[model samples]
Target chain A: MATHEEITGSLQAFGEGYQKNKKLKIMNKDWDRVILIKAADVDSQHTLILKNGELTVTEGTPAGDPDLVVTADSETLADLFYGDITPTEPYMNGTLVIKGSEDDIVRLDFISLMIWGE
Target chain B: MKRVVSVSLGSSGRDHKVQVELLGEQFEIERLGMDGDFDRALAKLQELDGQVDAIGLGGIDVYVYAGNKKYAFKDGLKLMETVKKTPVVDGSGLKNTLERETVNYLLRETNYLNKDTRVLMVSAVDRFGMAQAFTTAGCDVTFGDLIFAAGIPYPIKTLEELEEMAGKLLPEMTKLPFHMLYPTGKKQESRDEEKAKKYAQYYRDADVIAGDFHFIKRYLPDNLNGQIIITNTTTAADVEFLRQSGASRLVTTTPVFEGRSFGTNVMEGVLVALLGKPWEEVTPEDYMDLIERLEFKPRIIDMAS
Candidate 1:
């Protein structure tokens, strides 16, 4: 029986792995800056840089400019990552809040599918 | 004209609006404030005891005090024994109020039993809501839950999808009702087939079944094999299929529609279908009337989430 705590733990661990593999998908010359995704419950923020074939996620705010920022409630965020809720619906429903250009949002979606493999 | 009356203090779950809509019109509802006292709540209800049909002993708290040292420490089973004559039902407040409209529709409309009148519950997600609806509408209740570790997900779009998928996976007669066991691999496919096979076997043996979707037909061989699959659906196609299958009962699936979903209106119609008199008795006009009468902005409490 996986308790709620266990679910949160697994999500955190998966997020770490996701950070490492993100850059491999963003080889296009135009995509070089960082993307920020802040889930509600984790307390701290995250900075993911996808420039080269390798990806990197650090604990604090990004030193360089961030290309995009996405924020949402904990439940919605977890469901989005887990495929329970699709990305576009949440934004339309206001469950997820996005702050970035249209290009950045599309690129973020591509990165999400690449990281989560869906 | 009044049979056994069942009422609850407010509604429960996210579908309070639907439950309230269904319950408000047919039955006399006693609203209990979040800060209200239990004894006072019961006394207010007792005022309508003999005047109406029957006194439904709303929520469990009405009988047993929640933080009261005497009842909390001691067993409160005696309370039910004391109030046996009023035909008291253990109704839920949260779900009834939250999903009020749909739940009210189901309670007032759906037929739980046929000629045999054996009211067996298929899913336990909102057993309190089901109990409130059926018992109020006049039916004896038998309820159970599917034992699982991962936990059954809530408020799917339809039960037919549930039945179709579960039936396809474990089609063997031996594992007739897949919902009896823990349904694994909800959002995605299960990485391990061995685990899935083990649970399917467990479902094969279990007698009672419960879930949001339907796959019970795959488990049962014949129509008269004493199999009942109770599921909630929002799709018109599934609704038509359920009608065609001659299912024992089909409750509408009401998701907490804080925002708009395409299926909410259809789900509302399904609730009305189940809660109103008989399936054959109520018409499409009746459902539309109920929806029109019950429409209201859902109450959004900050702490509720």
Candidate 2:
């Protein structure tokens, strides 16, 4: 059993790797409205929003109008970047869901393949 | 006892293409160059009325290369209309084509190849037909990097260069333009079986191995005992190596010829080999009976000619 901090660190490393590779640059350059939704927080608790590369929470705040929302478990999210599960298949199978930006979904799918080596 | 018919559609020269196989022995293949209006293509097929058991077409690569999606749906609809009774298999439906229903149809009706006999397929589109052939023949396939994403091993610019690479790398290969590997090593002993072992996991179960020329080279087991089919490729040497490598047969189409897909060639070639007839001489009658026996009646005519 790995610690949550360890898993988050791994995901952050992968995110940095993807950034270094320019595989998954967030389109439209608006990081303030981007949110990562964990599966455990389906009720909208623990929403991690990135603003100027800083993290904050809109916990219990009326589910704000974010530009993009990525929803998946931490493990699945980690594996998404690692290329183990196909994003398209997962999306189709309901393992992952993205809202607020179809373009972001496309970009995510393309970048996921580049980052994950699929 | 269903029959099998395979068809392909894509641009004549580009790499993107599709192949579809239907269960039965007979086939009705209607091919048109990527040129001409869809109406004209429909006219050509109308002439073959009641003659085809299945229909395949080509040209997606040209569209992708040119970034034009025009006429694609029209072409598909036109072909669909022509082969009203035939099952009109095309490359896009690979997943649906390879179901248990289809495989059982292929095995029960045909006196299929059993790995020892060499069968050749030309211009197989993508990896679908090759996968089906793998299930039918029970032998391993190898190829070069053009099919896989891994990159070409040898530097080749011309067909002759490819052939040279094939001879120098794989002397025992009997199939050319295989989607497997272009040998960088001469002796099978020098060839890296570990690499083969590592890559085999990706396609150990796949009937067809898809990769660039190098991907084929990477995945091929050192001990191969069957036939090979070459799809879209440019290297002549790879073809030469395949011929040397105990490949029981080799199938190829004219270079850059798209409308008349290599997949159709693969299907017709295998069927000819199975029926023991010269490939060119094999006729629609041979396939028609298979379709009739299989009961894979074509869809009712959706539109008038």
The per-model lDDT (C-alpha) reads 0.38, 0.38
lDDT of 1 by residue, B1-305 (tens): 23333232222221122222343443222222212133444454455444533333332322211111111101122233344333333322223333334445533454333232344443333334443454454444343222121122121223333233223222121111111132311211122243334334333332222233423322222222222344432234444443454443334333323221212223333333334453235454565455465563332212111
Candidate 1: RMSD over Cα atoms?
19.8
What TM-score quantifies how close candidate 2 is to the native fold? 0.30
Interface RMSD, all models, one decimal each?
18.6, 15.5
State each candidate's chain A TM-score.
0.66, 0.59
| TM-scores vs. true structure, each candidate | 0.25, 0.30
Least accurate 10 contiguous residues by lDDT in model 1 chain B: B66-75
* 10 residues in a row with least lDDT, candidate 2 chain B: B61-70
Model 1 stretches with alpha carbons more than 4 Å out: A1-118, B1-94, B98-116, B135-138, B146-211, B214-230, B234-305
What ranges in model 2 sit over 4 Å off?
A1-7, A22-35, A41-64, A81-84, A100-103, B1-52, B57-305
* Tens digit of per-residue lDDT, candidate 1, span A23-113: 3333333456676767656564567676643456565578766777877776666666554545655775677787886545644554454
